[model samples]
Target: MKTSMAKQKKSKSLLRREWVKSMVQNRYLYLLMLPAIIYLVMISYRAMYGILLAFKDYNPKLGIMGSEWIGLKHFKNMFTDPYFRHVLLNTILISFGRIIFTFPFAIIIAIAFNELKQRHLKKTLQTIYTFPHFLSWVIVSGVIFNFLDYTGPVNSMVAAFGGERKVFLGDKKLITPILYITDIWKESGWKSIIYLAAITGINSELYEAAELDGAGRWGKIWHVTLPCIRGTILVMLTMRVGQVLNAGFDQIFNMSNTVVQSTIDILDTYVYRITFQQTPDFSYSTAVGLFKSVIGFTMVILVNKLSKKMEGTGILD
Candidate 1:
């Protein structure tokens, strides 16, 4: 036991020495990382202390640390709330809807861009497709309202064609589809940039070898392009899974109205409403936020495990 203890201490000392040596050798690289490390420490890690509010009866007179402990009272109330259940279901539905409909468009667009032979046309199309991503949700919501309003050009065209004009935004059945469509339009092209980059990094020799084997464009893409970028796709998918509960707060908040409130009320908006629109309940809101974070984290872990099982690689790995 004495000899083992001495060896362990020696190993630790050696490790410390090696770490100091490496840090000194990479001083410039560490300097470049200092700002990011500081930001994470200050903005991200420091803010984690507020998570305690979920377990406290937060009072204005007493700050977070001084708040009275209420140990799971808010969590119990949250679990029992019928409205919360509805909101959670809505959040899950919307999140999965995006995964099903919006996720693949980026990959498809990236592949399509890769297949394009005309450089000028590709650049122009890419610019047009990606331009929407820069626009704030407020602007996009306003444009959507203008286009879909009863007296707008879309309705006029419907009237011209002898079809009855409809309230697209206010209709519950239409609202979710509209959200999916608009989300795809606004974000897919920008998301495609990462996939395009992955495609660009694929070895050229693999394609040449594929062609030598008499493989066509579609064949090369199937066997070479996709397989080469599978790891990147899995990594992005794992990250997206981590945000499964988000459900696009900015877009929904901007586009939502009283008529469509029940259909589109998600967790973030519910927290906002309870905290700001209604009587302030900081502890309850914090509990809801904590719940969301837990679920998102769980989803990320599950997806990462599945990714590793299927692809022999994972985001965590």
Candidate 2:
């Protein structure tokens, strides 16, 4: 027993000495990594110090540290506010609408792109599709205004056909579908890149065997292609679930009008309104932001667990 104990201690000490020697030898490499570590500390953790404002009755005169703590006050107000249900409903509807409507479109488009035999045509199509994603929401909004406004080309076409000019952006009934379709237009192509990459990673031999076994194009897509890319789908869905509350702030802010506010206003816009439209109550805004973050974190955890249960794997894995 005494001899065994001595050997264990000697082995641990040797390992520790080796680790120390390796680190010292690579000290310059460690030094090279310091800037990124410092940037992360500055950008990610430095702002965490301000999170204390969430629990405080912050006053500009008193400062964040000087303010009185008021636990759950903002949270309670947030949940119980009159517009809470509306904003929550819109946020949820818009998020799930994208999942149901836009997500499948991206998948289909990816599969369609993967089927293209002509490389030049495929590359051109991909470039055309992805170009829209590079455009800023501000610029896209301007283009949308140009295309959909009362005097725009769409309404002109309607007028030519002797049909009534439609309100595309502001009508409550039209907003949900408009939001989803526009999202599909702007992001579906770009989002398909992940699926395309996943498709590429799939073994070509699987497809060759399927072809020999009398599987048709559609059959192969349904049976082989989809199953292979299903993990990527699950991971993307998990991420989308995590972002359920993050309704596109820039798009909503730019495209929403007074008439459509009740239809499209979301949690992010609510935070902005509180901060800028109302009194600049730092505590209140921070509380709202913190609440959003907590919900998103909880959602990611829950969905990741659910994915593990159903698929025997998870986004984290």
Candidate 3:
């Protein structure tokens, strides 16, 4: 007992000393972060109270606290709905497709940009690429419509080739792929910026040393370049997996019509349709959103755990 007590005392002393040292060294930094800490407490933590609606028959008239509880009814309704399956599938398919295609392209663009010796040309190209990221889905929709409508440039070109005018946007078979392709074209360049920053941070001496030892461009990239940026890639991938259920709601909603809604309807649109257009049940929508949040939060924990086991450095640690 005495030995154990002594060890405990020593540990307490060490912790207290470290805490004091940290407080002295970083008190100003902590003070600077105070506003952000308070903001998170007010916004993030306070907003969590809205989740109580998921368990209640929330009405604007009755208000949140006075609402009658009807636990799990909304969830049960969701499970029984036939359209839920389609929405769930669309969400997963679109999110996964983006992850698979977009990530590698970002990495490749970053690597290629790092290879360019002309600074002016490289900056100009990057600026051009980044321009599309600023365009909202509404603007993007207008641009897409102009090219895809019956009498648009595409149809004119097709007519010149002796082909019939095609309604690309309205076609169920084409809409999902077009959504994915257009999304990639719009966002990939901007997304590559972070990866390019990571690539630029890699030590030039490593590449020079490899070249000195007779390594080619491909050889250096395979060995040095990829390994250096793998951590950033892993973190980005884990974040994507955490959000695998959210598949560009604004983009989908703007681009989709009745013709392609079956193929492109996702959880957000489903919730919006149920809450606003059909049932107008605030509680049901809250329940659905809460369920989505739970699933996403759980997925982040599970994926982060697996990533820690595989890669040693997961998202958090």
Note the Cα lDDT for every prediction shown.
Answer: 0.94, 0.89, 0.88
For 178-227, candidate 3 gives per-residue lDDT tens digits of: 98788878888998999988988999999999999899989899989999
- On a 0 to 1 TM-score scale, where does candidate 3 land against the true structure? 0.83
TM-scores for candidates 1 onward, in order = 0.85, 0.88, 0.83
Query: In terms of TM-score, how similar is model 2 to the real structure?
Result: 0.88
Instruction: Predict model 1's lDDT versus the native.
Output: 0.94
* Top candidate (lDDT): 1
Task: Indicate whether candidate 1 or candidate 3 has the larger TM-score.
Answer: 1
lDDT of candidate 1 over 42-121, digit per residue (tens): 99988887999999999989999999999999989988999999999999999999999999999999999999999999
Instruction: Give candidate 2's error at residue 294 in angstroms.
Output: 0.6
Candidate 3: C-alpha RMSD to true structure equals 4.2
